[model samples]
Target chain A: MSAVEKASRPRVAIVNFGMGNLFSVRQACLRAGLEPSITSKKAELLEADGVILPGVGAFGRAMETLREQGLVSVLKDLAAAGRPFMGICLGLQLLFDESIEFGRHEGMAIFAGQVVRLEPGIGPAGRPLKIPEIGWKPLRPPSGRGWDGSLLEGLPEGAHMYFVHSFHALAAKSESVLAITPFGDMNYCAAVQQGRLFACQFHPERSGPVGLKVYENFRKMILSGR
Target chain B: MAAVRFIARLDVKGPNLVKGVHLEGLRVLGKPEDFARHYYENGIDELIFMDVVASLYGRNSLLDIIRKTSSEIFIPLSVGGGLRSIEDIRAVLAAGADKVCLNTAAIANPELVREASRCFGSSTIVVSIEAIRQPDGSYEAYTDNGRQKTGVEAVGWARRAAELGAGEIMITSVDREGTGQGYDLALTKSVASAVDIPVIACGGAGRKEHVGDAVTQGWANAVGVASLLHYNVLDVVGGTGSYEEEGNIEYLKGRRGFSHVERSSLGEIKEYLRGLGLECR
Candidate 1:
């Protein structure tokens, strides 16, 4: 990028946890008109204006990679300082207290919740809602007076976002829940907005135009009042 | 509040978009990115990219295209065609694919479905069944562009595939492919009702209503289209229609129930269905 472009762009570090595809996250950042860098370096992360934890695959492996890369303590520090951290999919699950996937795995504990398997049941139509509920589902925006969309500020009320997860988070406090998505007859927490930390259980980078708006909102949220 | 998905399926050869009759008589359309951009701008719910020649040529050919498209197009991208091993799946996913569709490999090694699902999570693996109708009215799954036949029945195998941890089933009717007569409602309904997971019905979609038929009558969670969606886009020089053509934009808008100019639009399928009360992206 040219000096002018680089100088003007907002640098967002896509944390290299080594589990998911960080390319798409960088792409989304670029689409949202921001400068993105995928790195595990503490200095680079600390220097950047923001951090995004893009994840896929298993949660235990992701946390292990984070620990191996020495990203756990750095991320904990960044998150503790409210450094505008965001997570996606398994990254979202990793923000919780713990999980019981292949085995019991402890998480970053930024959010009070436990990741658990989606209960077996039928959807509204009576057809069985299969596990790993793949494809797009609408987001049920938060209703409380102060629990607004926040990072999800610009998305439509019921905007459909792509999701691919078998385990869902059950937040300890309801106010932390930013949005919910239908998994069968019941709904699961789709996103959480705790302090400066914002994360979703879907691939916003892969959810088309509205999904782009999410990154745009995140950039705006991070850049404002800074 | 998740609505039904209307997807655009593009079969690629090298860097170019290509489509065949009955999945044969392959004809080059244009750059995969052009059509992908057009579809995305027109509000396509998702995209499926199949490297039609990966088995004949090499899987490497699609990596560049997928990398470029995944970087530009911000939507769910499902890549298929010659994916076999876990390494191949890893390479494709690394190249920016959200899900990898498996056909021949999954059939050749049923354990692959279990292993991939177990490793990457079931949501990332899509098992495609190209079904051919038998004289006895039962449907059988075929692989390798329908050149090879798997004796397993479509409905029963879909259930087995799901049980083996296949998260989603993309059932394409080989008999109806490229025909555009309409989706094989019976075949689609059978496989869709059989598996609890989301089903992507491909093949035989000529009219906009065919998409509707797939959801209402066939119970498919989503409809995948190629012929009816891409046939008219590329002009004589194998390029996407000249940008001067405002018809597709108008048609796309009109389908969203907007009042405006009238003309031939590529996404009429979604437009028509959107008017019929099916929530479309």
Candidate 2:
């Protein structure tokens, strides 16, 4: 296949470490018009055009699986090398320095931040709201830096996506933050971009057409260059 | 600031989407996947698939239905009914289901909620309750298709389930199910207030305003509808009339409540809710 055509059908390695529903992620990848191979194998990650670190459940257990499956170094290398990467929910949490959930679990430290619990009970409306913040929430309007022009390229300024998480990422540096979403007491970093590396505390696959649009834009980014 | 989720609940029996009033009467609709597509295209926020008769023999059909729906429908899907063990929950997730709603199993062993939540994250474990009202103005949680009472009061049990790590509590009012008398607002509000997790209010929605009431008055994070959507299937007289896929054509042939149902379109409902100042996509 020609380089352009080959780039158009980029293969993404969905990192699976005994956490998350890999099938749904794989399905989302396919919906984004990309080939997805759910694998824990090191060689698969090396061959793909991009990598997706999808995760759920406890941070400690997930870190254990990642270490045991021999993926920690590979992920760290990708982060340092600035490869196209995306993390969802717990995957996004795992990208930070540490998390307070189930004790202090050290993350990949790919970005500088700590994951902390959201303020529970009262929401912005002053009415009592549930934690774990389920359902669809709108992303705060992007900063002046905005998106990198591919991943969020045609997406509305304040597009909403499905989110289901108690803990959120807190960027140590404001410059690393790409998007902020409000939750009751305050607004936190909902999405961050470190060069080609992008991570979000929301599930793009579950966010309906807008979510699918996110994947489509990411797919275009992967196809734009060598 | 999350938009309230508008869910379409489809109950399956064997290979067909079945509808009943107050969780009874047994009316066949169409194929679950086809119905799911209709709602997905119409801008539904989420979907819930409950296998009305979830025995070991009937699981294959449900899995097939889910696998098909997940491929085309790119929204969050919560599947329930006959999920008993951690393996069963895993199997549902393996079939591309985003979340699993546990009613009978979670009730039998409350630890199952803890275990499943631990394995598949609390967000993926939704504790579903079929609440039947009592004479003394209390609601009892029922299992086995609401045939047997678990004696657990709706709000209290919902709190306990959330404490045990259940991510969401889906309370369906058996008393108001298919009754079109508007949601059991009192029951929904109580459970919603009791849990620290999201509460999904199901049943008793014959009007568009009832859905709005569930969010405003009932404090539900999401609203689940069945007869209002399934009974009022879109394009029954015009499109999706070919291939005779599964038993949908036959069911549609004998379809009831095509135009008689008092349900509004998904767009209309979202527009109405947004007009009411509720955030909706």
Candidate 3:
């Protein structure tokens, strides 16, 4: 709670639009040596040196809550301002232009993409692939790309991170795709980076040490003012 | 296949972390938070804290423990035992549990699984089925920590739960639990094959090979281990914090170990799994 008052450290606002637990996100920030404030106020989010949009819930419900809180435009403006902005899990889905979950829903349109469910299919090993790919999966860089200047800089290739979700983002602009994770017979866009905005479909806060490095990278980005 | 998840499951009785054989006669080990932190520091993929006495006592007391753990350890945390309603599930998720495992409530009211999954996404809801083998070679679902039988077939219940909207299924064998005889491979394979959702095999993992066997042979997507990891770290992570309750101080005081359960660290288990070419985080 006192983390927000520390003016000497870089401030990171964890956007709370009534999704789910923000404590783990805040804790991860503190461990990363960044001051995190869990707030919904527009002024607090706009004033932070960096912002993290973390969520866990349905895509429709989360977008509805953000619209109700009048935070849809606030998020768009934060992305426009080019601050170190990030999203996790459902937060990553909300960055897309629209989501086909439950029903057709509009996202913040930060990126040109659509959120879609992981269709049930067959695994390469001749087993039925499960929906809601809920476990640890290694992240692979897109073709001809690697984690050099992105938030995943220090992480080794194929570093496993915890993921728990049923839907994933399909960016229309393939160049924005930072990482892809293999599940069953297909690979999904697991992380993306565009300008100052970085988002991932995995919960780094719940992913232990390999995950903590992600926060550390975010902190470094904030400190460098990049 | 994705990397197999290795979860450290700690059963809690009152304020102290407890372990039992066949889910009964729970002996207090230490504070749940202590064990949770230790596991987190040691690279556990996930953590499950089940309030073992919550259903019998009609109350859940894992919120504070979860709040404390979530503030430090960064890993997926699943909580079970005594979650009977949407509000109960919501309260725990709000308190920092990423997923809520429903057993007694899901069986008594199958609609609860649908309602909860609808309210809080299917991935957030996990249906925990505690199974005990019967005379006819069928696994029967038991409630209240294996103290009450629901007369429902375990494999059938797992399929029904998934159909009703459970994103994951955790099948724990009451017979193999705490006995260190290895997991009930038959029970685990039956439920895993019955549902397309991820299945976590729990109970009776006494060796690293057992952990490997659960995935390679039993077809489990994950494994929930207790004594194999808990008894191995008590000496390093010491805590009897704020537990004035009776029967909570004897086990740690004596430093006695389990003969049935083998001592192994989380790192060792993962290493052993990797040696088998089984991908584990």
Candidate 4:
């Protein structure tokens, strides 16, 4: 295949640490018109045009799996390379330096932030809205460049996406923050994009068609050498 | 004022979408990805994709459908049908399903519910009950896609499911299914009263009033319906005609204008919930 053809059919690797929604990531990549491969293999990470880190469940367990698989160094190297890389949910949280869920656990430190619990003060319907805010919630993009310029292209601002998490990201640096969603008494960053790395607190795959467009945007970026 | 909640269900057979009466019969619709996108754009609180043939296939093909659907639509998607073991639950959750609904499996092996809850957390497990009314005026639980009678009472099964760590109980009335006669309020209230967790009333729902009835009279936290929103299926002509002769053409055109309600951001949903006096913990 020609270089352009090969590049168009980029192989997107979904890093599997046995704690993430990997199959969804793989399926999203395929729908976005790319070849998706799931691997804990370090070699696959190096060979792939783009990488995705997806997670669900606990931070401590995820860290344990990542460390056990020796993917910590591999992920760092890939991010340092500036290839198109994205993280979802705990995957996005892991891109940060650490999380305070169930105790302090160190993350990949790809981004400068800390994951903290959803503020306990705000209650919905006279009852605690509960942890892991389940179901669909809307996202508001930042002004100026907006979502279209980065990983969120083709998805409309204020579009509702699926979310299922108890903790939210508090970016250390405001410049790295790309989007914010208001929950309870706090407004926190929902998406962060620093250079080629992008992370979403919501599951784009679960977000419906608006989410699929996100994958398509990622595919376009990887193909166009962005 | 009470906040309205809507849930969209996508029935799947292999990689394709399908719908049927009860659970034995089915007709293919289209690719799940397409339907999921349509529903997300149209304003749905949550989506459910049931692998109608998962039990027979001995595996959840809904995983692949979820993977495909999730990539396109950013919405909470629940997968059901053919969940027999913890391994099956793990595979489905790992495949991008937000929650796994257990019906036949939960009835057969109640421990599986506890095991799944312990491993994946109770919030990720949902227990689905297919209930049919017997001659004695008691609703008996049926399993194996509603093909076999369990002789277990619906209310009792619902209680057991919750006790075993099922985060939510989905009660479906098989007799009232696809009939659009409104949900079986008694069935819903009985199950809801029997469980501490949220109860979702499924089966028949034909109008907006029915939605309110499910939430109020039925005492259900949520309601699940399929036929009323099938974009590809025709409406019952005066409630008559074979489903096949009705044809797979888009009906209800120009009769009702679609909602112009903008998609609320996560923050907005929180605000709305707050406005409703809900505590967002």
**Which candidate leads the pack in DockQ?**
2
Candidate 3 stretches with Cα past 4 Å from truth are: A1-7, B55-60, B238-244, B248-253
Question: Where does the lowest 10-residue lDDT sum fall in candidate 2 chain B?
Answer: B237-246
Name the better of 2 and 4 by TM-score.
Answer: 2
lDDT (Cα, tens digit) per residue for candidate 2, span B186-230: 999999888778889998888888999998899888999876766
Q: Rounded to one decimal, what is candidate 4's iRMSD?
A: 5.3
- Kindly report, for each predicted structure in the order presented, the TM-score of its chain A compared with the true chain A: 0.93, 0.94, 0.94, 0.92
Model 1, docking class: medium
- The list of candidate 4 runs beyond 4 A from truth reads A119-130, A142-145, A223-226, B1-6, B10-55, B58-77, B87-98, B118-124, B131-168, B173-176, B184-199, B212-222, B235-281
Per residue, candidate 3 scores C-alpha lDDT tens digits across B1-281 of 66889889999887778888999887888888888888888888888989886742333357888878888888889999898888888888777788889999899999999999888778888999999999989999999889898889999999999999999999999999999999999899888889889999999999989998898778888899999988888888755565567345666777866788779988888888888877776
Most accurate candidate by TM-score: 2
lDDT of 2: 0.83
**lDDT-best of 2 and 3:** 3
Candidate 3 residue B49 Cα shift, in angstroms, is: 0.8
lDDT of 4 by residue, B1-281 (tens): 11234567777676556656675556545556766666667666678988776732334356656666665665567888887888887777766777889998788889999988778866688899999999999999997667799889989988888888777888889887766678899999888667656677898765545655676577666668676666332221211222333223232223232121222233343354455443221
Clashing pairs in 2: A136-B2, A137-B2
Better of 1 and 3 by DockQ: 3
lDDT of 1 by residue, A58-145 (tens): 8888888888888888988998898888888888999899999889999999899899998657554444565666678888765662
Better structure of 3 and 4 per lDDT:
3
Tens digit of per-residue lDDT, candidate 2, span A10-87: 999999898888887788788778989989999999888899998888888999999999999998897677678888
TM-score of chain A of 2: 0.94
Candidate 4: docking tier:
incorrect
Which 10-residue span in candidate 1 chain A carries the lowest summed lDDT?
A140-149
Write out fnat for all predictions, comma-separated: 0.65, 0.81, 0.78, 0.34
